[model samples]
Target: MNNTETPSFEEWVHYCFTQGYSDFHTEPDADHYEAHEQRRQRFVDIDPKALSEHIIRLFSNPAFLADEYTDQQIADAVWFIFGLATTYFLHLRSEVVPRNVQIRCIESVATLYTDLFDRLCDKHDVDPNKSSSKDTPLEDAVYMIWDMDCIEGAVMFPKHWPHLVDPGFRVLETILEKCRTVTCKESALHALGHIHMYHPERVEKIIDKFLASPDQPGVLREYALDAREGAVQ
Candidate 1:
C-alpha cells in the first residue's frame, strides 16, 4: 500500500471494498488499534486536508451523475466515505490532529453527508412535499442519521467548536421533523439528547414540541422523554 498514492475512482472503490473494509474491523486492543491508527495516519500525517479532499472528489465525479455506475458501486463508495468519516471522528476525539485540520475534516464529513443525501433523494425521486411517501430507502435515512451522529459526537467533546453547533442542530432538527424512518428519527432524538447536554435551553422547545405531538412515534416519544430528563439532570 503506497501511502502517498492517490487512487483513481475504480481503484478507490476496490481498495475500500477489500482492504478498507478489513481495516474498519480492527479490534480496539493496543496493537491492533495502533496498526489501524498508523494506516489512517498515512493519509493525514503530512496533509491532513488531502484525505478528505480525495474522498469528496471521488464522490463528486461525473460518473455518479451518469447511469454507468451500478447501485452496488455507489453504495460501496458511500460505505468507503462513511468509514473514512468515522476515522476522521476518531482523529478529532483523540485530539491528535491539529484543530484547524479537525475543523476542515468536520466540514468535509458534513458536506459529504449532505451531498449523499441530496443525490440519494434525486435518485429515488423523493419529494420533500410529500411526507407520506415511503419511496425512500431506510438505508438512505440511516446514512444521514449517521452523519448527524458524527456531528453530535464532535460537539460533545470538551473543547467546543462554535462553527458546527448550529449546523448540527439544523441537521438533527430536519431529520426529526421530516424523516419517515423510525430508526433514523430515534437516532436523531438520541443525538439531540447528547446535544442537549451542552445547550439545554436551545433544545428545550424542540423536545417539548416533539413530546406534544400525538402523531409522533412511540420510540421517538420515549427518546424525547429521555432527552428532557437528561436536560434537567
Candidate 2:
C-alpha cells in the first residue's frame, strides 16, 4: 500500500482485513519490528476524521457486506484498527488528530462493538454469556474494550467530555455481566476501573457483583479485585 495516497473506504477495510495476523508468541526480531512500523506509517497521512467516517459507514450499512472475509480475518482487522485508533488518541499523533477527531474515532469503535453484538446476539441468537472459542469477531472486539497497557482511553474519555463515555460504560458493564470469557471480562473490568475516580459507587457495584458471582474464573476474579481497589491493570 502506498503511504502517500489515502485509501478509499473499501480499500482501507480490505487492507486491514488482509494484513497477516501475528500472535507474538516469541519476541519479534528487527525485521518484524521494521515491517510493523512500516504498516503503521502507511496511515500517517490519512485524516483521522476521514478514517473514522469510513469506519462508521462500514459498520452502519447492513448491506455493505464482508462475506468474502473469514470471521477470524475480520476480527484481526478489528484488532488492528482499534490499536491504531488508541495509539493515535492516547500516545502518538495527538496534535495531528485533535481531541474532537479522537472522540469521533472512539465513537466509531463503540459503533463497531454495538454492531457486532447486535449481529451476534440479536440476529444470530447467540448467547453473549456463554464462553466459546473466542475466535469470532464479537468476542475479539470485546477483548479490545480496555487498553491493558494502562493507556486506557474509552472510560477516561469522559474526564474531558462527561456524557460521551456513558454508552461505552454501559457496553462494558454488559460485557462484564454477560461475557463468560475470562480475558474479555478482565478487559471490561479494567476498562470500567478507568472511571472509578469519578464514579466509584457505580464501578464498585459492578466489581462487587463479579467478585460475588459463583465459579468465577481465577484470573477474571483477580482483575475484579484489582478494579475494586482502583488499581490500573
Candidate 3:
C-alpha cells in the first residue's frame, strides 16, 4: 500500500499483517493461481480445524505479538480476527467441524474489543448485526471494517501492516458508499486502478462524488476519472 514498484510475497504478507492475518503468508503464489484446478487444489489440502486453531494461537501468543504493537493494537487484532475466524469457520467451512472449538476460543477474545467495533458501527447507523458485525455476511461487512474511521486506529500500532493490501479491488467494488472523507478516499482512489469492472449506474455516483469533493490530490482526481473512463483511451 505504501508504494512498492514490484510486488512480492513478503510485501503481500506485510500488507495482510495489518488486517491481522499473517498466517496467509504461507499460501501458494503466482504459479498456484495459473489454473482453476491449481487454485482448488490449494483448498483441498487445508484442515480447517487445524488451520483455525493454529491461527488463533499465533495471534494470541505474546512472543509473536509484534514488538511495535501496543496492547490496544493487539487487542483490536484479536477482536477483528475473532469475527473473521467465526465467519470463515462457521458458514464458509465446506466440511463442518464436529465441535468447532475455534468458535469458543474466538468468543473469548471477542469479549475484549467487540464493544469497540460495535460502537464504531453505531456511529454510522449501521447495525452491528445487520451491517458490519462479525455475524454479518463478510462481503457486506468489509466496508465497515476497512472504514476510514477504523483503519487509522488499527494501523496506528502496526507499523508493518502489509497484508491489508491484498483485498484491494474486490472490497472496493462492493463497498457500500464511495462518498468518503479524505482518509478513506485515498484507498478507494488507489483501488480503482485495480478494478475489473463496476456497474455503470453505481459507479457514476461515485465518480460524481469524487469530482465534487474538494479534498483529493490532483493526481488522485486524475486517476479517479481515468478509472471511471477506462484507462484514458
Candidate 4:
C-alpha cells in the first residue's frame, strides 16, 4: 500500500501481526522492518483515534474470540491493545480520542484477555507455579493474565468506571478463590488494592474477609494488610 492509502481494518491487523507488534514471529530485515514501522507511525499520525476505534472493533469481532486465530496471535493482539492504549493514555492523554472511548477500549481489552485466560485455564488445567515447556499455549495465557492484571491495577484503576470496576472486582475475587499460583494470586491482590482505592467501603469488606479467613494464603493476607495501610495513609 502507498503512503497516501490508509490501511483497512484487515490490512492493519495483518500488518500488526506481521510486523512483530503482535506476538507472532516475523523476521524482516532492517529496511523492511523500518518500512513497517513508518507505516504504523503514519497510521497513528493520520488519526490515532480512528486507529484505536478500529482496533476495538476488530477485537470485538466474534471471530476474534473464536478459534480462528492461533493462541499466540490472540495473546499478541491482547498485549498490543495494552501497549497501544497505555502509550496513548500517557503521551496523548486521551486528547485525540475522547476519554470515555479510551476508557472503554481499555476495559474491553481487559475483559477479553480475562475471558481468554479463563478458557485457557479450563482447557489446559494451568498450574501457574509449575514450569512449562517453552512457548506453550498455557504458559502464554497465564503470562497474559498476569500482565493484564498488572495493567488493570496500574492504569485502569484510576479511570474509575463503575461498570468495569465492579466486574473487575468480581473477576479478581474469582482468581483469588480459584487460582492456586502465587503469581496469579499476588497479581489479583494488587489489582484488588487498586480497585479498593476508589471503592474503599466495598473493597474493605472483601479485604476484611480475606484477613479473617484462615484458609486464605498468607501472602494474600499480607497484601490485604498492606492495602489497608495504604488506604489509611
Best-fitting candidate, measured by TM-score? 2
Taking all chains together, the TM-score of candidate 1 against the true structure is 0.55
Write out the backbone clash pairs for model 3.
Answer: 14-162, 14-163, 15-162, 15-163, 15-164, 16-162, 16-163, 16-164, 17-163
CA lDDT of 180 in candidate 3? 29
Tens-digit lDDT track for model 4 on 1-233? 56746678776666554443532235557768776556656544446676667656764543554465666765565455445422432332336666566555544544443444444433455344343322455444444443453345433554543334554566566665665554445545565565565667777776777667676655456666776544321
Q: Please give the lDDT score at residue 114 for candidate 1.
A: 41
- For candidate 1, the per-residue lDDT at 232 reads 18
TM-scores, in order shown?
0.55, 0.58, 0.30, 0.57
Give the per-residue lDDT of model 1 (tens digit) for 1-233. 76545545455555554455456555658757866776555533324345555544544443443254444544444444444534544445344555555555554543433444333433444333333112433344333444433445666654556655655566666666665545445556666666676778777777887778788756457667887656311
**C-alpha lDDT of all candidate models, in order:** 0.52, 0.56, 0.37, 0.52
lDDT of 1 at 227: 73
lDDT of 3: 0.37
Write one digit per residue (lDDT tens) for candidate 3, span 17-59. 3533333323545675354333222332334555445444543
Q: Name the regions of candidate 4 deviating beyond 4 angstroms.
A: 22-30, 43-46, 61-66, 84-93, 127-190, 193-233
Better candidate number, 2 or 4, judged by lDDT: 2
The whole-model C-alpha lDDT of candidate 2 against the native structure comes to: 0.56
Model 2 lowest lDDT segment of ten:
117-126
How far is 164's C-alpha from truth in model 2 (Å)?
Answer: 4.5
